[model samples]
Target: MAEPRVSGDVKAAFALLITLAALTSLLGVGALGWVVAPICIVLGIYCVLRAPLRSTMLTLMFFALTLENPSEMPAAGQWQSPFYMVGALLLTHFKTVIGGPWFFGGMDLMLAAAGVHWFVKLRGRSRGIPTPKPMIKLAHLCYATIAFTFVIGKLNGGGDSSMAVWQIDRVMYLPAVFLLCQAAFTQPKDYMSVGKVILVAATIRALISMYVRAIVPATVDPISGESDLPYTTTHHDSMLFGAAVVLIVALIIQRTGPKALRLAVLLLPILFGGMVANDRRMVWVQIILVFAALYLITEPNAFKRKLQRFALFMVPVGVAYVAVGWNQKGGAFKPVQIIRSAVDSDSDESTAWRDLENFNLIYTIRTKPLVGIGYGHGFWEVWPLPQVDYILERFIPHNSILGIWCYGGYVGFTGLTLLWVAGVYFGVRAYHHCKEPYDKAAALVSFGTILIYYVQCFGDLGLGTFTGVFLIAPSLAIACKLAVKSGAWPSALRPRQTA
Candidate 1:
């Protein structure tokens, strides 16, 4: 067959995009001058010429941005600050895609790209822009509502300005990533490629955590307290690492690649060891829940066999943990010590504090009920005034669901619950609709990962950070797209061009 001709309209639009990029670069030259201008021009040209490479480049950038640690790389911060890492990575990627020095950052550019793509695709179609599926629409609505409520609360002097901005990003910008990803992941192969990127990123993180714990133990030490082995950053980064572990195992169970499987098995000790060293009870629970969910979702009939296989897998892992713990000053690896910490409800300071926080949340909810004191207001009510600064700075919430209830009231709480319900529904539908075993397995794995994070959100802010949103949103988008493509849902909601 002859190569399909590029459309005239597409060529024209691309030309316009390039011109705008050039203008932006020219404007920046006045401010940034000679050195930055030439590099931007070259990168912009490369991006236009290598348009197909955009996805892979963005994936790699995502990995680098996630792995960046400002505390550890203060020197690098002078050149590129951690706060702007995501923005910088995104701007560079967008500069290539749009063919100029686009200043928009993070998910904004992606969302705008998706919108433009949709509009272009709709140009000659009878149907207008197709409404997204109900669940997807509801998710967008929830994020928008929460964002609006947060801003209003902030205007009312309910929370600190910086924290309000962070919360707005978490609620709105992060979930918007799903729409951007949906625009790119149009084919099964594309979805698989994204999965591979995630696996590679996770594996790198696992390896780095192992190396850090060994070489710079103090660097990995628990921010909450000292530990023998360096622990992964708690709440945020640790949960992210745990999510990666879950994804890796899910992909392996799906049998993504025999070679990759062998490598992953080799790295399992390091991955699991990092999880153990992280010393977060919630992460440990997340790991267990993910495995159990994966088994039940993917192989419901072979429970006994799966249990045997898992037990065999644990043997080497347990042995490695013991071996590592043997040399440490404290028996951080000792089963007894770990178990004591997990179960010590009355004595463990963290546990006691969480219990108190939970009580305070409950009390506040009962008092305010419908529209609880806005987003950050609960912190002041729940904790002492002196500790409010520390608590607000960390954005720590013992129970995320309750925290939402405290922040946006029942309306926000219900919206979030429905979103998860919709996620689980679509995830199951994806599995049912997929004809290929691998696709089915991928669907299950993605769903299971989201489920793990959803469950974690009940007790921790696992689903409230950029890392958590990035991991879950793309997977959710993949599953939903599969569901639409496989005819599990009506095609009415899928963009006509996408269908």
Candidate 2:
């Protein structure tokens, strides 16, 4: 497929520029940084100046994965913790002066300081920080869709003002981070560095999960006398562990860099153990889908062919195991139990509720049908909803992809779908274009992460959350950037175009 460069990317660049400026200035980004957020700004500048690639490995966000987002009210997800962490240092939300309209927090300071560096370092470049053209356009489309939808919402008196704004803000994080990532990461080494950081952070998160699991006692159902492990981590950790497993496996498969197999062997077991300990059924589904997608994207080779034959041979045995183990009481068939819990809603209360919730979202779409009920509006429930402990049900759904279709209607859904599919498409193209083993491994990892992201979106509220945006946006950037480097796609550079 020909990856054509489009006109008006300059406009997109200008839009990003505007976003950065607006965030910094209008948000009072660092009005009181001297007292509270100095570390974040200093850290951002340090990363950019000292070693943009290496220094950013894990400073700002590793701690974020472990904590919840309480700095802001009605915490969206753990990913939101970064934005609130600065104020959270005092364990309090900054009043209107510091974190209010005139003040920004740690995350705000970091982004502002980093944006300044990005603009200065990549100054006067036409490649415009190496972003994909279509993504730039889609970012604009997303913002425009929000405007259109909000007008419809306001006219109809559709939803709560605050919830609507919160949803819209989360929606923008995807494209905004997409732009930031494209501009910030400048080379293959940057991707490799960031990937290593992700592995380390996620590995640590897994360890904490294991610790939590060990301490938390299982809750026995009063009626059935069945014990269930309390969820130790958020659903988003599944993405973290799943991506790590895939990346390490690819490294082992390709032997991409020095001591790659040794490194993979060291980390793979821990990540897998973490997944089992976390006890998320979706992890298995995501890993299976990501591995399958990775296989499809990669060029056929002797090892892959052998693996295919082995899989084919195991198909019958795998089926029989599932068939027999579906109802087995033995703990030896736990993997089957997990898989069964995913597909057979009767096996788990979580899955059963999701199924019922999905019906409500589907019914909502059926009624709205066209422009959606618009943003801020709650999905109309056709049936009584089972009470969930989660309070954000009206705004964010477990099946966020379905929620997008339910809330944004056809136009919004199409825009997001294009971005999602295009990410994998470009990732595959990058994989084929890269010649070096390391580059190939990087592309493969990025590709698998994006696929895992898809699973997260469907199985949980992954699409609009900060975790999903940050993960996918950066992975998407790596793929798009690598594709440009490998001459599979055009860069935004104005002068001597050489890949």
Worst 10 residues of 2 by lDDT: 72-81
lDDT of 2 by residue, 91-140 (tens): 23234434545333445445555556556765555442366677668766
Question: What C-alpha lDDT values do all the predictions have?
Answer: 0.56, 0.67
Residue-wise C-alpha lDDT for candidate 1, range 79-165, written one tens digit per residue: 222233333333333453334665444234444544565445533343312223675677677776676567656665666665665
- Candidate 2, lDDT over the whole model: 0.67
Error of 2 at 305 (Å): 1.9
In terms of lDDT, which candidate is strongest? 2
How much is the lDDT of residue 81 in candidate 2? 24
Candidate 2 matches the true fold with a TM-score of 0.81
TM-scores, all candidates, are 0.70, 0.81
* Most TM-score-accurate candidate: 2
**Error in Å for residue 170 of model 2:** 2.6
